[model samples]
Target: MAERTSFSNEEYADILFYYGAARGNAEQARREYGEIFPNRRLPDARVFSRTFRRMRERGTVVRYQGDAGRPRLEVGDDEEEILNHFQIDPTLSTRMIARRMGRSQWKVWYTLHENDLHPYHYTPVQAIEEGDPFRRMQFCRFLLNADVEDRNYLKRILWTDESKFDKDGITNYHNAHYWSVRVMGNPHLKRQKGSQRRFNLNVWMGIIHNRLIGPHFLPQNLNGVEYESFLRNVFHELMEDMPLETRQNMIFMHDGCPAHFRLAVRSWLDQHFPDRWIGRGGPIPWPARSPDITPMDFFVWGRMKSLVYATDVPVPNIEDLRNRIINAAQEIQSELTDSRVVKTGVVRRARACNRNNGGHFENEL
Candidate 1:
């Protein structure tokens, strides 16, 4: 195990004085502090600077009560009230909770842990409204009972969706954290919202078993006519690639977008897929706002987004963004699809949704 790295309150006091006396020269402060406390090695400049800055900001060199000064596990009506507040709304911040409960933030946090309560980050999900639970349950039950040729129905599913990728869409700094002696600041360049350089580009794609198809970038906004054209001009090619028997058994899956419900698109789907499809006006009513069950929404899009923006190389134009998306889609391997989509994950998700009585589940699609 590593040595205890946290400094004592006495050491913090000495460091604070030296940091000020040395006028923020971290190295000079460290050397001066070492002269006073010969037995203890001074922390690195980064740690020293962070601690010093924190002390100044908090207006104290002494540690917070629950974290460093003392471990306060004592509970009363106050602690119980804090826990109850959190139980009612888990999203309540400790600071906000402290303000409401007239208690220290640290004490409230400690009490929460004492009661085996911890704050979990909120997950982004499609908002489920009234009657969605029944729809979600029905969808899960269909998947659970679905069978084709004595095999699971998922084997024949062509899960498809459209996603928008922005040229300047950068990951959130809050979502990206550094685990070290001190928290590091984000260094990635920031882009302003609604800037011309930050324009969004849309792509349509489908996933079937171990195969990924068509990250076709839309040159214009997708409407009923464009969606119909895509189905005729692009989606047919997807069908042509598969064996005749596979095509016969396959079930097309898409969300209930306005374009998907348009008469022309519905006519085409009716003529081509007949009863073998999942969506509005088909055999199964795909649950509204439940992307957690779709491979494209939860897994494929996230994996591609992470890959597309991962590099430090600048995407100067829409073409560059398109190329990056295509490359990322190509990099999605068979084994990855086998593990994420073809395995028991999709079925397990349906079961989880069913268990929750059609309520929104934890993990994303």
Candidate 2:
């Protein structure tokens, strides 16, 4: 069993005063509280400072104020409504209420959690609209169901997701800090409308471990037949290009889009590379709406969007978008070259298997 660390409420109070909400990080918090010190000393500014900074960044504390460049969070009007609503009734969401009240969704989420009133997020929020989460989860299940030692040796697992990249695309991920005047103005008015949402780079990205194989943008006006053709072409290209050991064992994962699932496409996959081609509906079992578990979900698109969309680059047309996406992908590939994600598909699937007893994610995939 894991050894648990324990402390009394008084010790906890000392911790909060010295290290947390009491502004006691480093030099100040320790001295003022004067609690038992394991090392009988104050923590250096860097250690406590970084931990506290991460706390602030992760929204553990409402706002870090009084210091230089620190943001001051002003309490908003609708907080009581959130505490009352989510607390009293279970089904309502910060987003739902905000939509009804015509407020920024962030403001609602912030107010609830900041006040220590937020209920746990019961499910993983869907990042992709119209995406089947369980289906994506099932694909992950299939990948992990393979011989782990062999798959790990060959790095043979891959998954794909689509994105539209625009030269002027802005896909930055931001912390939702309500009460920061810098982010949102007075309660009387709303933030300016039409901050960038979508981008012009429409790409189909293929991800495997630390490697990014493609940001393959579909040819203009691609449909089901075209997509199926691209699959055949890409698989041939991918398999042949691989080292000898890897080419024989690779599993190509994709969602159940009409292009992927159409009978015509199925026939082609069944005819040519019968056993090599693995898809959502493979024998292993899969779930829809499971991007929350896929490598592409965890590693690629969100990251790329954060890089490409977060910028103020100029992309007025598809050509400009394509150029920017190309440049950005190259830059990201280079920057993330030394970075390889350790996959958790096996661990996660094992837990899911426990939950299922005998069933599997790929049962429907």
Candidate 3:
């Protein structure tokens, strides 16, 4: 248990004000507070959160600790067993765990809370196959070495990916928020029936240096031939606008999709990019299931999606959706790409992955 410290009323107000001004993200507000008061110890995130909620409800910051006098259950053998079980499998619910342990659900819940144990939903990622880490390390080393020799090496590479967008399926799902005093629920979005098939569009795009090459909607499902066809139409166009130097030194990056490795696609890439492509059957193998280090996965697609679906106004049809995507693409600036995608994204993420031994990077919670 954290020791109870009595803070001045002024200090409490200041903390609340800082948190509100910085939005409701506790960590962000805490960071700002740290910058302002380097000498004073800021409260833990949970403490800050509880105080902020109280302020929101009462419109004032108070020093009273509501449950301070209540006796906390002592950590005994039973608590240790509960902690052990929870540590082994966080998916076990309080009620289920209590039943298993022959204890009350409230006791289990209290024990978990006292121990600072909270359940978090799993984040989805692609499953990595064997030898994926070695491939990732090798590819990152290749880029790092090339960058060491030529500073512009990263800028010369084209980052590409395909994503599906559903017009009706755009909401901040799984983004529920709960206040300390009240459960503040997300607004329900009434989804239309048969919405996904009717409204969804699969689009492909490529980013090289400052240029966003395509919001090209794949006419049908992608196959070896279709992917090759898209490349044939867009590859030359992507290269044509670049400088002679960049064009000569440029590399192409794509994931290890079967379509990408097919003979037709491989042959076309070989002709256009030669040994400068990164993927299966190419010069450098792109690691399987490694999206954290890819600019397309980590940056481009996410930014574009946020831009496209940010508006609450319903997209009328497929054409409007495509137009929205194109408009979003147009709004994407060169500086944004240069700063976010290439320098901070690819290279920085590469180094992070290498440090993690090719495992997934820890997400900022």
Q: Pick the candidate with the highest TM-score.
A: 3
The lDDT per prediction is: 0.71, 0.53, 0.70
The window of 10 residues in a row where model 1 has the poorest summed lDDT is: 177-186
RMSD of 2: 13.3
Candidate 3: pairs in clash:
none
**Model 1: per-residue lDDT, tens digit, 286-358?**
8877877888866788888888999766678987888888889888854464554643667888888998899
For residues 53-159, write the lDDT of model 2, one tens digit per residue.
54557644223434445453443557666556655654466677789878888777666545433242222133333444444444544555554646473256666
Residue-level lDDT of model 3, residues 192-270, one tens digit each, is 1221233378888888776777777885467788889888886677557678887788789898877788998988888
How far residue 130's Cα lies from its native spot in candidate 1, in Å, is: 0.9
Poorly placed runs, candidate 2 (over 4 Å):
1-124, 127-154, 167-199, 219-222, 233-241, 283-285, 335-365
In candidate 3, where is summed lDDT lowest over 10 consecutive residues?
Answer: 178-187
The weakest ten consecutive residues by lDDT in model 2 span 180-189
Q: Considering TM-score, which of the candidate structures 2 and 3 is the better prediction for this target?
A: 3
Taking all chains together, the TM-score of candidate 3 against the true structure is 0.64
Candidate 3, which segments miss by more than 4 Å at Cα? 1-88, 92-111, 120-123, 168-199, 238-240, 312-316, 334-340, 362-365
lDDT of 1 at 354: 91
Taking all chains together, each candidate's TM-score versus the true structure is: 0.63, 0.52, 0.64
